[model samples]
Each structure stands twice: as structure tokens, then as C-alpha cells.
Target chain A: MNAADLPSSCDLVVIGGGPAGLAAAALAARAGVQTVLFDENAGVGGQIYRGITATPVEDRAILGADYWAGVGLVDEARASGAVIVNGAIVWSLDPARRVGVSIAGKARLIQARQVIVATGSLERPLPIPGWTLPGVMTAGAAQTALKAQGLVPDGRTVMAGAGPLLWLLAAQLLRAGAKIEAILDTAPRMNWLRAAWHLPDFALSPYWSKGLALLREVKAKVPVIRVDRVEAHGRDRFAEVAFGSASGERRMKADLLLLHHGVVPNVNLALAAGVAHRWNGRQLCFEPVVDQDFGTSIPGIAVAGDGAGIAGGTAAAERGRIAAIAAVAALKPDAILPQVQAIRQRLAREEMGRAFLDVLYQPAPGHRRPVGDTIVCRCEEVTARQVRDAADLGCEGPNQMKAFLRCGMGPCQGRLCGLTVTELIAEQRRSNPAEVGYYRLRPPVKPISLAELASLPISDAERKAVER
Target chain B: MFKRLGSTGTEVMLKVDGKPVRARSGDTVAAALLAAGIDHCRTTPVTGAPRAPYCLMGVCFDCLVTIDGVGSRQGCLVPVREGMAVETQLGRREAGR
Candidate 1:
């Protein structure tokens, strides 16, 4: 099929189907723009809102189902005459707002007056010795497995890491009949108390009460420990986890370990399109540098969601709506900016709340650095010692480590090892992890084969756009 | 949300590792497995830590076990089938191994 064979043009093209993308598409279509939303997942909610489809209505109340519930957004967008495209993975974005997408094993190019990139974030993996053990997983991944797939890790489980997500996941596991061996949270004590100040704002809603109730039920049934770090051990698989607690270092034998630190933005498409970006010290990731309009260096192209920065679901959705409005305003300058300004103010408030929550739930500094012998990159089986050795050899950056040891050049595109590598280098350089900067996300983020690119439907216009 | 199966007062029987475990049909596999008191699943390759369903969704791979000899299957996601054979997978095992 040729590019012309597809829809010649649309008013807007939203490149992700998560809360942000869905919100953007819905708002754009509501404004009478011909909009299409595409996503790689079979469903629309993205990772943060994983179980929207499977969770029953009664359970939805406790799960914050309405918060995600992107299906409703999709239906509303479709009602407004927007095109919904599932399982569509966008490969590249040209300078002219032309998007190359892969669907049904075929690639095609779509041209739009404006494009919104709401690609969500990926979990930041903390590499420790034996992290590659079969039983280990990210907290977000665990949520998806249980809520979507109805799968369990084991009968006995240990939930470890920082953030409110740890407590949330632990509660879910308890409901699922898994014996919670321990809830090992690495959040510093001071941070937790400071984070508690925001509790009043959160507690205004009954929803917070229900969440706390569920957590209380779980805590009553299991031991919840605040630890500095976890040292997982097993020859071929994980059998024991050793951690230093207030009492002392304790080792617990368990069948599974769920580890989560936080998330970083997915910036592959933005970087590939040569969009300007800067490092966000707070989230420890590189976010696309955008103006108050959410407009990137590339004209008519906007970004939101975890792709812009790790602001969680509600913030991502708000940012997405803002980006969509800005994109429309770019074409229709006569459009009202009052609504946009209001939404931007709301986003700022949400972002402030998120920042407060993040500081309170941030991982303890000790968790950032594993013992020198621990492996940092599971894909290459690269050890902390190896990375430190490279840093000692004056390997100044993660790029040099990539060149010397191929640490961040794995299948995961460094989502798992990037932050850890940066921290390792910082430790060697006697500097802060923020000063070291995050890894650069290269193009073809999800890894498209050469044949896939060759198969893309191209037109004279799209071909010209690509050439430029 | 409500169903009646056999003499167990409408309880549904799901084959976990080829053994009949009775649970409410609407209950998640993790919940049912936990209710049935079957806890030990696969062990972590590095730490040998005993793991169970941590996140009752697909985000964490901690709940992985073999259903009908298939490895890396999230136990929380795999609904209880009538006669599914679930096994604990250590890692990505080679076909011949």
C-alpha cells in the first residue's frame, strides 16, 4: 500500500493510546478535528492503567479503575468520530509531522497537521547481584501479570522497593491469596514522614480511605519492614533475600521478589526526530525540552505523558489534553487560550503534588549503589565491578561504558540499566548522579528491523519528508 | 461475580498443576491459589528466594510459573482451567533441556 493509499491527511495524529494519548485524541476530535489514536498494546490504558478491562465494576472502586478507564475515553473519541487504532507501534516521526507506524506486520506513513506523542514511561530496574533470576520482576510488570493475565508469581512473595506503588502492589498480592513474606520498603524514614504531610490532601477523598483499609488488612496479615537494601541470592534462581533493617541484617527465604524503584520517560521517538531535550534532576531521566505550549523544537509536534517526564497517570492525562489543545491552537490561532491556561494551571498543581509525593517516596541513596561485585546489566551480564573499572579507566559517561562494555545497548534500550550505570559512574567520579546526567535515547526505540522500514508505505510527500 | 459449580456450594474447580482446586470462578488465579494454600512456585535464579504472586497483575514477572509446561506464564493472569497443568519454571529452559 502506498502512503496515499492510507488516509491522505488528518487534523491530528496521537501516537500513543494511554491516558494522555486518549485524552488528546478525545479533545481533538471533540473540537471537530479528524483525529486518530494509535497504540502498541491490545488495549488503550497503557501500563499505569493496566487492568481497566479485566477489573469488575465492584473491584473498580478499590482499584481506582475510573482513573484509568481509557476505554470510556476511546468510546467517547470514537463517538466524536476519531479513529482508534490498536496494536499500532509508531516507528519514526519525520520533521513534517509525518508519522511512520507499524500495524498488522506492515508499516505505513500517516501525515497529520499536528502530532501528539504521549508514549508512556518504562520501569527503572535496579540491578543487583542475581537480578536476572527468573523470579524477579518490576512492580508495574507484576501488576499487569496479576490484573490482566490472572497469573501469580508464587505462593510466597516478598515485595521490595520504594514508593507508594510497593504498598499498593503488596495489598493486591495479599488479596490474591499470596502469603506476603515481607514488605521491604527502601524509602528513607525522613522522606516518609515528610510525604505524610500530603496525606491530608489525599485523604479528602473516600478513595484514599479504601486504599488505606486494604493496606491495613495486608499489614495485619504480614510483616512490613523498612530496609536499606536487599541482597538476593540463589545459584540458578532466587531462594533468599538478605536486607539490612533497623534491627540488623536479616535474610528471608522466598519464592519470588518484586522490585520497583521508579520510572523514566520513553524518549526514543522524540530523540530520533532530533527534538531538543534536557535532563530532569528530580525524575533522573531526560525529558523533551518544550515550551509552556508543550511544543518541541520541531514545529507542530508536541509531547506529553511519561514520555515528557514521569508524572504518573493523572498528570500525564492533563498534560496530554494541554498538548492537544496547544497543537490545535498552532493551526487555529483564533482558538481560545483560556481553557488551555486553566488546564495548565491544574497540571501545575498536580505536578507539585507529584513532586512532593516523589520526594517522600524516593528510594534511599544506598539502594542506588549495589555492592561492587553486583551485576548492573543483566543483558550483557556486566558487573558493577566491570562498570567501576571502566569508570576508573576514565570512562566519563554511560556512552563510554556502552562503547567499552555495551552496558546500556541491550534489548531493553537501557531502560533497566541506564540509571544504575549513571549512578555507578557518579560514584566513581565522586559526583552526584544528577551531575552525571541520564542516558540518551537513540532512534528506532523499540527496535524495528531493516525489512520493516523498507516495507513502509511511502508517498512522494512522505518520501520527501523522510529525505529532509 | 457469583456462580455455582458443584456440591461445594457453587464452587468452581480449577486444575492447578493438574490438581483440582476449588475456588470461586470470579476470583483471580493468584487469589484462588492463595486461598487453596498452595504457595510455593518458582524460585529466583540468583537469590533462590521463594516467590509468590506479588503484583496481582502482569507488571511484575515474580508470579511466573508454567501452565501446561509453558514457562514464564504469569500465574496471576492464567485463569484456572478445568485441567491445566501448572509447573514452576526456574528460567527460560532450552527445549531439549
Candidate 2:
């Protein structure tokens, strides 16, 4: 995308090109409303459907049905006549529906009548000891590489932590012909008892059959260890992973250590835009407060997809359609959206058994709140001890801790460390995560060069306000 | 530690630490680096410890590398271009390049 190709203003601007944004943009455009979608990646598919248009992998069967389902989304979004822009880094979105975006290092501000943020989710950070080593990466990273580049880990690989996605990735990697050494399951066995209450709904849901098949597929090939404690051991790059189970302590030589503990709503952009958010104890992260229509506290802005909450990709698309229908109705008050009810029905079905998955996958307290010498903030290299010590000194919340220890002030802007720091503080204070609160995020949400800001066209009124 | 499962038809060349590395057309700088066996992209600014791309989705800054003439570019976000120059960042950005 070039700077000149950008619009000065638009009817509806959708940020993120995931399942939610794609569905929303396609619906809005098909409804005769002018819509523009911006995605940071070179391709339109968000992480779940990454490389839908440009994947290098020739054998489509290896990626499975769920991964290829994104093709319809990309096709519909492209055919709907929405102005879709790729390689667009949206840095700022204000309460007034003004968006600051950069393309190819050129910046522009566009005023939007209605905005839909469908930024989706990022993998929860697993901050075990030596996790910052070179060979250690999030499980999502491996999936992205495989989906986009047809690359696989050639060396001995050991995946730690537990979630539905972890098993899915293991299955995908094995199908891709990648070698795996072991899978260290960090999910507490007792969670099964707590999650049993929701078993009826889960058994009826679509995930039951697919999850069973996936687990069976991976379990046949890989050594699955139910470990209570796990850590990476390496000097410069990852060389091995160690885990302690009911039997005893054991170690495995590994060239790659993929870590996962489920995903959380990526709330930085929505939070920085002044949307109301609360800590979701069940999901163990902060999520934007949204109503049935997916509308945010800001009148014209809406949040959909995993960014609103951690529903899967299919549910996210339905949420996006609902939000888009609401947007069309708001922009043109007389517009009739007969499909709204149908979309909601689909969403309810898609969201079936989500509670069971959430309860089953909720990370243990120890994993979320690591202690001792384990590094909490990867950017600042601040250890868990330092954060605990700061909390003991009466550091109120993430903001005060940032001022005191510079934990969330790094280049990543608290994306990697905010949840860990909040949990650590909450544990130390014997308070809940909600009371501890999250970092007060500000914009330029994604980093932008100073030169990009300097090149923006300025007006006399703006200049006078600053000059005085 | 990573290998390409197949080719994407066209291949491009990039310089990682002043050495030419062959990369597929659609691969990001980070993916190309990983395939070329360059694990760590940069050392952290605070302690100068080696760090690699943790989250390839642009959330983690561990993939920061010097691209072209600019410093601290997200290698995972930037697609590998033909004859692009990528340097491993040792520490914090040097003053004025």
C-alpha cells in the first residue's frame, strides 16, 4: 500500500483483517456502505488464517480443514468491493473515530464515520526460566511459519504448556513431517473436575469430536508428559528442557522449545483508544467491555472477534457480521438487516462449550504468577523477585510499577509483560488481578518512526494550538 | 533450526550480518533468517543478552533487526526483498546510524 492510495475519510474503517474484520467488511460493503479494511500483515488473513492468499505450502491437505476455511473469508472480503489495504500499520485510533495509520513508512490520518476493531488475540506469554533464549518461541510462531512459509522445525522439538491450540499445532507439525521430542503438558489434572460441570454442553459442541481426533492423532506419535513443573535450560540458545512430574525430574535434549498457555484478547489498541476493559478471571486477561451488538463505550467504535473476548475464529466471524450489521443500521438508520438474528443464532452455537474450554485451559496460578529468579519482563530483563519486591514496597498497580521499575516501559510497550506483572503484583498483595489493574496504555500503539510523524501535513490551526 | 518444506517458485537473496542468504520470495526477514540458521536476531538493550523472535506476530520486539539503513525494524513483519541488507543488532540503536 502506498500513502497516496489512502483515503482522507471513510464511512466504515475496519482495523485488522482476521475472521471478524473480514466478515464485517464483506457484509458492510455488500450492504452498499463504503468500507475499508487495514491489515498489518502482507496478507489479509489474520493469524488464524494467516497466508490464506500467499502461503507457500503446496499441499493444502496438510494445513487441515480449519486452516483452509479462511479461503472463503478472504474471497468474500475481496469480492465484496471493500477497499482492502495490506501492509498497513495502524498506530493510533482516537475516541472521535480518527485513525492514524502508516503505510510504507508514510503516515496519514483518516476520519471514519464508524470503526470496527477486530484485532484478534495473541498467544499468552510463557515466562519460564531461560524462555528468552534464541531457540525458544511461542507455539503460535511455529504455526505462522508453517502456514505462511511451509517451514518446519528440523531439529529436536519439545513443546511445553497445554491448550487446545497446542494439540492442534502438534498435529499440524506432525502432518508437516516435523520431528518432535516430547510434549510437556502443564494443564493441572484437577482442572478436569472443575470443568466437568460443563461437560454436557462441551460434548454436544463441535469441538468435542475434532479435539478428540486431534488428541488421538498427536498422542500416537509424540510422548505426552503430564508435568507439573517445566523450565527451559540453555546458555545462549535453547539446548534442553526439563520437567518434573509425579514420578520424578527428567530432561530432554531439544533444539526448539515451543511454549503456549492459550491466547488472550489483544487489547492494546482498544484500550489505548479509551474503550472500557475489565480483567476476566476466567480468561486470565483484560478484555474490552462490549454489548450484544459488539459496540464499545465509544459510540461509533465497535470491537469484535477475539479482541472483544476469546471466542474461536468461527464465532469471531459471526461477531463481526453482527457488528457490521449494527454499523450499517447506525450509518443508515432505515437499513433492514434481516440476517442479524440468523447471525446471532450462529454465534450462540459457535460459542457453545467455550466455558468448558476456558475452565479446562485456565493456566495454573503458579504458571501465571512465576516467582524466584524467573524473568517477568523480557524487555527490561526484570526478574520475578524484583517485581515481588516492588509489590512488597506498596507499589499500587502496573502503572506505579512501571514508574518504579520500568517494567512496562520497553519498546514492546507492555505487550509481553503486562499480564505477568499484574499477576505477580496480585499474588504478592493477596488481591485479585482486577483490583491490581492493567497498564494505562497510550497510542502510537504500534511503534512508528519519528520521521513518519514529522512528515505528516500540518495545518495552521493545529500549529497555532501547539505554538501558543 | 528451521528448514523450508518447499519452495515458493522464486528465491531472493538477502544479507544477514554481511553474508548473502537465499530466501523464498514470500518469507519474512525473520523466517528467512531462521531458515538460514541465524537464530538470534538481536541482543537486548538492557543486559545485551541474545534474543530471537518469540512471537512472530509482531507483539514481541525480540525480532528487532536493522533493515536497510533503519534500525529496530520488526523482522517478522517486514517481507524479505531482493538484495535487502539485514544486520544483527548487538544492543541499543547507535546514535544517528
Candidate 3:
């Protein structure tokens, strides 16, 4: 859909098409309010269920049932009369709920009564040496290629890092008949002890048996090595992976090195839009400060899904529904949202073992806060040493460090390196991440073309002000 | 770096760095480059270092390429099209191109 086809105003506008956005848009539109959802991807399933409708993979079991669950979400949103616009880039959102969206390289401003920012999560930056090499990609990227294009590593593949998604991606790749060199388990041994307190809840949670089965499935096929440190080594593209295990440091020839630690909220848009955010030490990232209804400090705006906080796909959908019901209640005071209470209960159940997972898979400080020549900011190619040196020179925060070294001032707008930079600065300054803070983001959050900006429909008074 | 599992989608013909490449119908430009083993789509503007699609989910700008007459378009976000002309961005895109 183009900007020309979109409504100038809507009762509700969702900033994503993932599980949360789809659920929120569906519930809002079903309550008789006009709803519109804008997604950057070509499809509605977001990252987790990418290519749900257009996947080239024929067999459903190949990508697994959890991925296929996104189809029902897309269907529900479409059937609910919500305007789901794919390939639409939302560049700006003001506290007043005015949204600047660009579609097909054409920009338009849409007024929304209520907005749900469901922009989901992105993989955490793994700042080991040589990570910027061509063949080194996040494990989520591998999953996207597998699900969206039925693509898998055709050469020697080394999977590194710790998280449920790591094992999940490994199982998916194995299912796709891809060869694996070895799995470098980066979950620090100390994490197991720290995470043991949350083990009781994890044992009762739904992910317990599923996580075990996934680990078993992948372990049965490939060698899983518990590694304390890992580094990607290549001149241009990833060719070898060097890792330190209990046995000792080992290096092996590799064609593709898929790295993943965990995922953090993609907070660029939310932060740029002036939503209040706080550093989450447990999650090891900055997340939007939100209320029980997922409402941010900015009124009329709600953040759901992993963007609000990482709680996996099921909880994202439930949170989306709850946010949508809240939106409906706010927009149409008489709107009856009978299932919100039940949805919240389900959401609580979905988030039962999240603490366990967070503590267990929390990336080690050595990996998160790199030293020496390891690159912290891929965009500016800033080394961790440079950032630490700047911090030692009294660089207060990420924003200050950006002026000093341009670490977070790249095209990615700090999505890749924001957490790493913040943590690095904090570690150097002998301060907590909360005290050190994050990048002060502003719009246009995602880069928009000059042509697209020029194409915006100008108001008469605004045009007069600029002309004079 | 990657290969297709199922060869079922309709064939999309495009050129990468002016070389003819065949990709699936649903393939994005990044997927096509990887499927064809054409790593390092663009050299970084800062240091001219070779880079490919690191995230493939649109967060990483490493996959920025020139599609047709346009410059610095995210390869992973743009879908593959027939007769598409993809150029490997050598460095920073020239101003007023």
C-alpha cells in the first residue's frame, strides 16, 4: 500500500505487524474503532513468524508449529477489518499521537486517537572480535532466512552464544539439513547458580519441557561445547571461529558463524518519540517505562510485545490484546472488553519463567563489555577501547560518547550497539547502567529519503511560516 | 553463506553488481545475494571494509546496496524484482546522485 491509499486519520494506529500489533489492531477494530497497522516487513508475521503467508517452505513441520501460529494472527487482524499495511516505514511519532509514515517512498502524516508501539525486539549485539565480518550474522538472521526464504548455511556453520532462540535456530537448521561444526554454549557456568532461584517457576512454566526437547533435539545431532569466550576470525568474511572451552581455547575453520546472546527491545522509535525509558539491569537493556496496561509515560501511547520487554511470542500476543482492550476502553468509553482480565491472566502465565531465562542466558560481562580491538559500534567501527578510554576521560553517557567517538551516531541509530556502548561506559566509569544512561534519540528514527520528506502534504499555515 | 532448502518459489531474475542472478519469488535482495554466495554487498563508508547482511532483519545497515538508480537502500527490506539492477555500494553514496 502507498501513502496515497492510507487514511489521513484513524481511531487506532499500530506501529508494528507482529503478534502484539496484529492482536491489538484486531481487538481495536473489532470494537468498531478504525484501526491501521504499519509494518516495515513485506509480511505481517514480524521476525518470529516471518514469511508466515509467503514462506517458500512447503512442509509446516519444517519451521515448526510455533512459527506457523502467526498465520492465525494475520488472519484475525485481516478479518477484523483492520487496515494492515505492509512495507510501511513509520519514521516519527509525537506525544500528541501524530504519526509520520512513509510508504512506497511517499511520506504522509496520520493522526491517531490511540497508538500501540509494538515494534518488537532485535538480537543483542555480540561485540566479539571480527563480528562485523561478512559471514558473521545473528542466529535470528539465520531463522529469518530459513523461515522466509528456506535458506540455511551451506558450508561449515558454527553456532555460538546462549539463549532459547540459539537452540531453537540450531534445531531448525538441522531440520533444514544444514551441517553444523559445533555449538558454543556461552551461558556462563555462574549463571546456572544465580538462575537456580527461578528454577521452581521455570519447572512449572510451559517452556520447561519444550526447552528440554529442543536442547535434546539439537544435542542429538551436533556437538554442544560449553564455551566461556568466543571470537570470530576472518579478514573479510567469517572463515574461522575461535572459542575458549573448559578444555582450552580451540579454533576451527568455518564458513558461517551465527552469533546470538539474546534479544533486547528495539527502542529506537519509542525513545525518539519521547517515551520515558529506564535501564533494565536484569534484561541488560533499556526498555520503555510502561504501566500495567502497557501505557507509556506519554498518554495515548502503549508499548507491547518484546519492544515493551522480551517475554517471547505468546506473551506478546496476550499483551497486545490487553493493550488493545485498554485502547478500546479509552477510545470508546462504553466498549466492553470482557476478555482483558482473562488475557492478563494468560499473559502472567506466559511470563512465568522469563526471569529464569533472563538470568540463565544473560550474556557474560566479558562478552557484553569487550576490550582491546573488539568493535563496540559496527557503524562507526569504534573499538571498545576507544569507548572505555572516552569514559575514563569523563564521558558521562552514550550521547556524550557519540560526540567524542561517534559510536552511536551511525545509520543504525544505535540499534546494534546502544546496549553495548551504555554498558561499556558504565563499566569504565564504575557506575551502574541506570546512572550512565542511553543514547538520547530523536526523529527521524529510521532514515527517510529527502524525496519522501518533500512529498509530505503541507498545511497552508506551515507552508506560510516556512515561506516567510 | 547460505543456500535455499526448497526450490519451489517462482524464479526471480536480477543482477547483482551487474552479474545475472536467479532468486526465488519471495526472496529479498539480501536473501538472493546470500543464496548466490555473493557475500560483502557493500564496503563500509567509514573504512571501506567489506560487509554483508549481518542481521537480515533490517537493524544492521551492513546490507545497504544501490538498487536501480537509488543508493543506500536496505537490501533485506526490499523484495526481489525482475530486471532489478543491484550495485555494491563501494563507499558513502555520492551526494545528489
Candidate 4:
């Protein structure tokens, strides 16, 4: 995890240390290709298996079996002898497969013949009134705190919005002895019809049992209300949550408000890497366009994990392995073909139940495009009305919206608000999100401190070349 | 504000704006601050309103704080260390060379 023996270049560089990246790096290393894995987190396991090495057996039990299952994977990865670099934030991944990395506040570039992008996904933005309040947080945030630090909400936490994570968190917290006031489910009642249509595939797959268990645990302990409209109201911090149901609106006092509509691919790194991306309507997120075997439009660059799409952790790991097999085979002509074939078979099997989950957890249309004065860009505080108004004035795409309103310009750099803006613009223009387009990402993809940039360890010759 | 579940880890003491906060050894700066009832991690540059960690992961970047004099570090990602000095990252400011 140190940069002490780090190299300036490698045969293959994997960006992200999540399930996919871990599998990719381990496989490539095992195949004898010089590999290096970069992760921003302190540990290797991504969000799903976060703190796996640190959490005790009893603690693992509380996190459930799916998380505990990753222990073996992490062990296998560590045994692979890959050069693992933790705390390395990949700021720029260009088309030429050059990765600009910042480690311990120092900047360096990694030149790789091939790069695997497995940056994973972010929670779908849940924009509502009082969402920016100090007590408001995404369900992923709550889960990350718990997974990484074993922290659980100490006060009356009101869980809102919809998605698998919403119910899963409620179940987890209930097990942790945390106080949960209620759950405001935002999925349409009609979504059951859509979910039922895919039930056959879901029942035959591995996720069915786990999904049912989460639902059972949440229903047995918590009061669940099915609703569409929700808003958090407070002065300084979140004081209460107001939501609507078929029975009409209801209000409840809350110490914390955790929101999550769903998750979407965190494609900033991939997009910044100059890969082609298409917006996925079913998942309501932008995903990189990768061909079968995870090779991006650009050769030698592959994307896996939720960064390519929200295929869950199990499938993401398989996809990662598949991408690794493919990339390594291309790099090393003598690489075994049978290994790649076996991984493909596993990946296909692992991907079976995704349709059911996607249909069942598809967020309500209201969430994708919030109406009224709901804020779309949290960083700049641009409202839906303002974005719609801009679109009404012939605003064409998200990039232009950025110029007019600064929607994607923030410390977060469009991660939180980009999809919302695209959806908003698409809604006004009467086109789909893909046709409406996305933000043109520029480097450094992650904002590097000026101090770090100035102190970049360029040799005098390299500096002179740049000066020339 | 949160607490550990299932098991206990070793505890570490850190400071937030000169105020002492006790946290588990592996607790992120944001988690420690939250456990100590300090919700407002930073003030925004645009509105000057108090903001805490929205996404405990690095995606939101709302948890930015000064850790050991390094400005704009994500509090939710930085593990708590003994005697670490923390400050709220508020507004636009220049970093000195």
C-alpha cells in the first residue's frame, strides 16, 4: 500500500480497487503480466466488501453472509502478488492510457499498455427540499459509515426514497439495534407488475433468497409506507420528514434523514478516459459503452464493475475477471484461452437475476426528473425550474446548461448532479437522456491541489521538454 | 452521530477545531465528528451554509475538511488518527506553498 517501490509505468494498470478491479488485478498478476492496482480507499475491498479484513467474525455476521463471502476473494487477491497501491487517487486517465495519480499529496503519472477502469457507482441523487441539511445523508453514506467504521445511526433515523439499498439498510440497522422511525418507499405500486414479469428469472437465480430475506427483515421490524412525493423539512438540521401516500400526506419527527433512489455507474473516470458512454434508461444512470468482454470503444482500455453498469458486486467481480482475461490475453499472446472461457460462463450465470432487480427497483419517474423548485445541482443550488427554464430557452445539452447555470461545476465535479441535469434537460427537450448528451469531462478528473501540481516531481529534462 | 455494532475496536482520540473527540481507531474523521455530535463538517463556498458528509464515500466531496493542516481532504475517507488536527473547510481559500 506504499508508493516506496512504485514504478512510473507498467504493463497493465487497474484504476479502482473494488470487486472488479481486485479480481482483474489478481487474475492478470496470476497470469504473469506485470500489474499494478490503484485504489483511493485505504483498503482493497470496495464498498460492498468494505472493511472485510478489519471487521471481526461477529461483526461480519451482522453485515450478513454476502459481505463475509468477500473474505476469500480478498485473500486470493492478496496472494496474487500484484503491486497494490492504496490511497492513490487517479485524477486523470487519458485516451493514451496514461493515468495521472496523486499519492499522499504528490502527483505522478503511470504509463500502462492497458488500463482497467472499475471505479464503481454512486448512489442515485435524491434531490428534495432540505436535502442539503446537515443531518441529511444518502443511504450509501449510512452504510459506508457502518461498513468502514461499524457506525450506526444513534438517533431516530427516517429512511426515505426507494431501491434495494433502502430496504437492505433498514434491515441492517434493525439488526444493529438502531432506532428507525419509518420507511417512505418511492417505488410505484405498479412496479410490481413490471417486477412480476421478470419474476421467473429472479426466482431461478441466487439473488432471490437474499432479496426476500432483506424484505422480510425490514417488514417485520419497521413501519413501511409506500409513497411517491417526499420532502425533508428543518431549520438547521433535519427535524422531520414529510411524505405522501395513497392515504394522503403524513409527517414524522426524525433526527436523521437518509435518502437513496438507487445507484448509478460512477463514470467520471471512464468518461474522462475518453471512452464512449450511453445513458441506460432502465437503471436511470449513465454507463460507459463497453463491448462484450468489457473492452471499451478504445482498444487496450476496458471498463468493469458498476462503472460499466450497475451489475451488482457478484456480477461485477465476474466482469472484472472476464475483462482481465481478455486484456491479458491481448497483451500476452500466449495467455490461455480456456481460462477466459470459464470466466465468461460464470459471468453469464451471475448476470441472470439482474433484470428482476432492475425492474423491481426502477425508481419512479418523479425521482429521475424532480418537478417544481426541487434542486437539481446541489453544488450550485440550481433548481429544476431553473434548469427547465434554461432548456425552454433552447438550451441543448448538459454542457451548455453548465455554461448558463454552472450545474456541473462544484467541488464534487458533477458526480452528484450530472445525471439529474441530463434528465432535466432531456425532459424539457422531449428526448431521452442519451440523446440529450452528458457533461464533457476534463482533467485533472479529480481536483488536485495547486500545491501538489506545483511540486510534481518532473525531471529537469522533462521540464525542459515541456518548456520547449 | 453513530455507534459501532456487534463488536468494539480500539479507541483513538482526535481533535476537531481544537475540541477533543473520541473515536474508534478505524473511524473516519467524519464518523468521529458525527459520533461527537458535530454534524456541520464545513460551510459551503456558494451559500455559506453548514454541510456535513452526504456520501460517506468520496463521491459527494461534501465532507471536505482540513486534516493535519492539509486543506480540502475528504473527512469521510480519512481514518481517525491520534492528535490529528481537523478544521472545517469553508468557502474559497488559497493554499499556501
- If the candidates were sorted by their DockQ against the true structure, best first, what order would they fall in? 3, 2, 4, 1
What candidate 2 gets wrong by more than 4 Å, as runs, is A336-338, A463-468
What overall lDDT goes with each candidate model?
0.69, 0.92, 0.91, 0.84
TM-score of 2: 0.98
Off by over 4 Å in 1: A1-5, A54-58, A65-71, A192-217, A334-338, A432-435, A458-468, B1-97
Candidate 1 lDDT, A1-468, residue by residue in tens: 223345857789998877888888888777767788887655567776664554432344334544445667656666766788765767788778878887645677777899998887776667656666645666776666555444445556787887657777676666655567888878788886776877666555333655567578778888878887688787656778888867899888887778888777777788777788886766666788987767899988988887888877777888888898887777676654448778887777666556555667676666776657777775455788899899999999988788999887754456567778888899899987667766666566654546667886556997888695
> Which residue pairs clash within candidate 4?
none
The better-scoring model by lDDT among 2 and 4 is 2
Isolated chain B TM-score per model: 0.70, 0.95, 0.95, 0.89
- Estimated TM-score for each candidate: 0.78, 0.98, 0.99, 0.97
Q: Categorize the docking of model 2.
A: high
- Rank by lDDT (best first): 2, 3, 4, 1
A286, model 3: CA deviation in Å?
0.8
Error of 4 at A311 (Å): 1.1
For each candidate, what's the DockQ?
Answer: 0.09, 0.88, 0.90, 0.69
* Model 3: pairs clashing at backbone N, Cα or C within 3 Å: none
Q: Model 2, A16: alpha-carbon shift in Å? A: 0.2
Model 2 Cα displacement at A255 (Å)? 0.4
Q: Calculate model 1's interface RMSD in Å.
A: 8.8
Predicted structure 3: lDDT: 0.91
